[model samples]
Target: MPLGVGFASPAAGVLAATGALAALRAAGLGAAHSAVEVSVAQAALLTVGQYLAAATADEGAEDEGTEDEERAGPGGPPFTSLDGVRFELETLEADGWQRFWAALGADRRAAARAWRPFQLRYATAVCPLPADLAAATAALPYRHTAALSAECGPTATEVAARPAPESGRAVPWRLTPGGATAGAARPPGPGRGPLDGVTVVEVARRVQGPLAGHVLGLLGARVVRVEPPGGDPLRGVPPMAGPVSARFTALNRHKEVLEADLRSPAGRAAVRGAVAGADVLLHSLAPAKVPALGLDADALTAVRPGLVHVQASGSGAEHGPGLPLGTDYPVQAYSGLAALVTPPGEPVRPSLMTLCDVLGGLVCAQGAVAALEARERTGRAQRVESSLLSAAQLLCRLGGDGSAPSLPVCTDLAELAADPRLAPALERAGCTLVRPPWTFRP
Candidate 1:
């Protein structure tokens, strides 16, 4: 029932929905939350695994630093000047006379530069005429490059392209009887659903945290999204639906929106007040910023005992606490995801989709709901932390060995809404597209 554009969105939706369902069950609302079908959650993870497999194979021939060298390959060459041309030769090899001159053309230089380490490696390793990757590529096409690389050893392209044979259905979520207490013990709210009385305060930006908040809203939590006075930066993203960004609408629908200047005392006080009464506080600020803002898990829980605090980051809290803030692209590079998608001896290329961000959001929602369950059972507050790096690792490890079948891309939302397979769910949800992929049966 999940519906969206891009490779990762649907899977992300399923993960989010599953987490919501789990939380509802833990809250003794399982019966009310049922009536949805659940899709497998590991599809995106397996895709990451496939990419990781390819990257690992690409690394087979080199020392540990090889990937680093490849990533640094582009900036090292300045293609506009004579020195740049000379440097290219030193690192790569040329082919035929005609191809050699053709390689010198600006378009080919641009292509070589764009492709980076792959073309560089091929030029350096396979060119009979030293110092001309453009000529080498011109003389030998990508298919030939793949073949020649294969002759030496298992190529990354071949490894990545190999079919993943494993397949299994996702395990359904379940909750024990007497798991969640009802009435006064539950947070007060207005809905008949499992999470109807739960209140969630979201202090986050962009896709990951907001998406989690969105899922919480879908599950019947009263989610209040706190943005800066100027509003969430995502609101400015293009492809607007009237005054708001469509992307923002999709991720943040059904949540109460509040704009506050956290830099001001009044703003801080407002947020603190909101958190003081909330059952869950979801945030995506840098870890350091959390303590500075006096919104760390300990601080918030002190105000509201048994509160579930979920924090999301690009890397684990300890690894890069002071480093430049992380995002999807840099994490992909750092995590070797970019290298994984590249063919052996080719330039690294990251997936166009924001896989890590989407998965990180899913993991955050899952952790948040699970923590809520734990808090309800134990009378103890919990701090749930998730990171893009951790999400990437999960994807790599949890993905099955078998390759997934190719799916045709949906051209637009209209096409998605029109699909016979999704129409029933859409109608049931009373939304334009399919509802959450999972439905619970009482």
Candidate 2:
């Protein structure tokens, strides 16, 4: 344990925590698998660890240079404290897997087999739990919490969970009554048909972009599906079903469908004219080809300043290559999305059609709504871009990691379909539970 030899630093702490979490998760600890909450904790730990390491190093360095004070730690992230701890995760892996494993109730031999390294550079500290609690916090798996909850029954799990109720009162889930209504209540009336008067100009390609427009149409947008001359390439895509297939119809339904080649001047003009009178523009133009298609933000804005422009791409605007330059599988593999959905190093086996498109569409729609609201307030339209990369990254749920999300957000078809409550919700939105494939095809 010489000077910097075996001393614990913030980065060292993050590595230890991440390693501990990984080991616990691999052991099938249910609590550890709760990605949402655990990631927050890990992020905090990393940030805190980074701060301590920096401060300790700065004070100990007798010949510290002025630049050292200004230079941010390893990850170059600003250190901010929350709940008294400041840290950041600089790297996912580092050396010293043996020590990490030993902390998690495993012998050195066992640790060697299971050990993998991680680095955390927390720059701050918080004093909430005692030393014992702090040490246990790093080693504790989420499953332990879950198991404890089962012991308490009904709502015991929620009660014992950390960030506990402010008053230390444990309220059971069943005991909590529903039906708290706010504002003036109005009498419920008869529901109307789907997409009665909403106007939509769908200049979409591939499954995700157009399918989103289709969903909007199903939910009551008067979707005018405008496609190129060859029709949506998906129509001719392999794995074809009957003349019209499930994939196509599943994505498109209840809309005024039109076929036009946007590549042609006349076609582009027609689209411009359509947009001038449309409420929303649904597009999934390939990023590289957006300008060529005359469908960039400026052009669309010129056509209809008030239009809610929603775009979906293979990769988001942030990334240089928006979509896969080649096939879907290769793109998925390249994005690392396929890996998360499938087994490690295995080919991606996506379920329920183009999952990215589906989720991207949903995200695009949500963004469009926000944009529309913004336009209403400011009397100006905003271009909204939701790329495949962004959509994929969101799916990954990389909380506080400063990394983009990486997967589609969706429930399995079976899970949603089986739930009786979800059916009414879908129906109310003007979405047809069934349809022909031709409807979805561009």
Candidate 3:
């Protein structure tokens, strides 16, 4: 005979304690129940143990930052900037970021028992993290960090590709005492690069649109990144390395950056003038605001017959009343995603890939490239668009389906992160689990 332990509140702790007895009382559950023990101390100890484990994990995470920084060098820290989010490379070592989050979701049974009311706040403030530290936090693979920085930012090779910086230096405009002196306009020279013959005028803000431009620039397109008169709000974003900073230079490089008040008559005219010669025009204007900007697809096409116009929206052009609710983070959660992350029954935090922006940006770029190719063949202009919601759905489907993806899994960030040799030894084989190596943070 065995003692039966019961939790007074009918909570899982009580159920787990008498698990064996209950299984013996039932028909098929005898083996599963035999593992249960009735001990409040045991339950509490398990909680304490995991919390302590999380703390140790945090310390190790911090140490990784210190050790890697010394080796990564002053100039080698990875940098990422998009929309208004900015973090210095070192901000990656933020204290307790992952540990605290993991602790919050540790015990589902206890969490469900400890219910509380929710409150709302009107505003939240975000601070920039140190560059090297942020690099550690973004935990992007070291290889990706190096490639993105070199490929996106201005490099020695890139400087060599262009005329000397001073070659295009501008002369101040001055009026002569009597009138203006007529100066000869410089003649345009040379054939275009693959994207050379193509001129891109990007009228966008935040990450998605700018990211597309960044990709285009990488492929030899001449991108003239235009922001409103105040400049892209992202310019004021933090993680500022110094005066000009890496965040700004990292994304807007390889192209001309100009600011104009799109609302003003002169600003609108300037954009229209630029549009006349642009092969592609990218904008993120809200659907309702599109008409006011003189940048609706119809207006843009009228100016440049074969312009490849690309736009990115939060919910896409499909949803009616449901559109406004489609932000990237929430979209990930709502799109059967929060349910699909590995450790099936366990609550997992969402990823930081900003998947929506990345995929949506890629889709827009794909559309622009396809449209350009089509124009070469058919000479017809078209509009290319994408939304955050759709991008998430596509990535989720591709991640796992009955049919396997052709591409390799870039990282071990999946629910089934298991070593075939180690998995067979576990007591519970049916449960989904994710135990990526601690070193796999990036």
Whole-model lDDT per candidate: 0.52, 0.40, 0.42
On residues 368-416, what C-alpha lDDT tens digit does candidate 2 reach at each position?
A: 5454434444455556766544544444432122233344633333343
Tens digits of lDDT, candidate 3, 371-408? 55545444466576666655555545433332322344
Top TM-score prediction, candidate number:
1
**What lDDT tens digits, residue by residue, belong to model 1 across residues 1-442?**
2111134544655465555546455446323443544454333332232122212221221232334343433332211232221112211233322243343342454333344343423112211222343334444444544344334332212112221222111321111121222323453233344466778999987567776776667656889999888778766543344455444555676788778888988998899899888888899898888888988876765577667778888675535332213565445444544444444454444444557677777767777777666666555667777777665545443443224444574434344445576444443111232244444444
- lDDT (C-alpha) at residue 436 in model 2: 11
The list of candidate 2 runs beyond 4 A from truth reads: 1-197, 230-243, 320-328, 344-353, 398-442
Query: What total of clashing residue pairs does each candidate reach?
Result: 19, 43, 22
The full ranking of all candidates by TM-score, starting with the best, is: 1, 3, 2
Best by lDDT: 1
